[model samples]
Target: AQSVAQPEDQVNVAEGNPLTVKCTYSVSGNPYLFWYVQYPNRGLQFLLKYITGDNLVKGSYGFEAEFNKSQTSFHLKKPSALVSDSALYFCAVRDRADYKLSFGAGTTVTVRA
Candidate 1:
């Protein structure tokens, strides 16, 4: 079975501060990891993906993630948070061969002005 867990329900950060959202996973084989952001009443937008190679992957909007294979974790990070970055985030994973993704419940990121 493949699954992802987002330990935080929400993360609140002030503008210009670093931010992080935790994520852990369990899967039978190599996993295709992905991060997505969703705004109010909108579908999820792709943030980044970790398929292979690099442990540190960068994505849209100054976002990045570190893939820790030994720990089975892929946590999202940003050097400087923004008010516009406040949105719902979801961590997802799929088996090496399967296209069906299993997503975390989601974490709401609230960036204060």
Candidate 2:
């Protein structure tokens, strides 16, 4: 089975500090990893994706993620947090065969000033 797990239900960070939201995944074959963010009452926007090759992948809104095959993890990171960055985050993985993405429960990021 293919699935993703976001260990944190919510991550609280002070503005201007770095932030991280943990995620782990399980898949039968090679996984296509993705990160998406959702603002209130809005659709999810793609942050980044780890298709292959690169272990460190950068994406929109100053966000990046490290793909660790051994640990089965892809944790989202940002050097500086902003209040505007507060939102819901989701980790997703596409199955090698079906190419359908299965998403994690989601983690809410709260950046306080």
Candidate 3:
């Protein structure tokens, strides 16, 4: 079985400061990690994915993630935060045998002016 954990329920950041959302996972085999952002009343939008390659992967909206296999963690980071960047972020993992992705509870980011 594969599972993902978002340790924090919410992250608050200043408008111009950086932000990070942490995620950890457990899987039987190699894990396929992904990050998605959801706006109010809208579907989740793909942010980035770490399939295979360099440990560092960059994605939409100036977001990047570092895949640390040893730690079983994939944390999303943004150099500069924005008020519009406030939304719900989710970390997901896909198991080799499963066709669907299992998502974390979700982390809500609040950017204060």
Candidate 4:
């Protein structure tokens, strides 16, 4: 079984500052981790993924994530924050055997101008 945990319910960041959203996962074998973002009244958009190779993977919108095998974590990061970056972020872990992604509860980010 695979599961994802996003410890924070909400994250608050100011414009121009670096931001991070923590995530952890559990899976049988090598985990296929992913990050997604959802805007108000819209579907979830794929942000990034860690299917294989490098532990650090870059994604859309100046976002990146570090895959830690030991800690079983994949934390999301951004160099600079923007007010428009505020959205609902999610961490998902794909079931290796099934190829279905199981998402976390989601973390809401509010970037103040």
- Which candidate number maximizes lDDT? 1
Per-model TM-score on C-alpha atoms: 0.98, 0.98, 0.98, 0.97
* Model 3 stretches with alpha carbons more than 4 Å out: none
lDDT of 1 by residue, 55-77 (tens): 99999999999999999999999
Candidate 3 lDDT tens digits, 1-113: 99999999999999999999999999999889999999999999999999999999999989999999999999999999999999999999998778989999999999999
Query: In model 2, which regions exceed 4 Å deviation?
Result: none
Best by TM-score: 1
TM-score, model 3 to reference: 0.98
Q: Write the per-residue lDDT of candidate 4 for residues 41-65, one digit (tens) a residue.
A: 9999999999899999999999999
Residue 71 in candidate 4, Cα distance off native in Å = 0.5
Per-residue lDDT, model 4, residue 1, is 86
- How large is the C-alpha RMSD of every model relative to the true structure? 0.5, 0.6, 0.7, 0.8
Look at candidate 1 and tell me the lDDT of residue 7. 94
Candidate 1 vs candidate 4: the lDDT winner is: 1
Clashing pairs in 2: none
RMSD of 3: 0.7
Against the correct fold, how does model 4 do in TM-score?
0.97
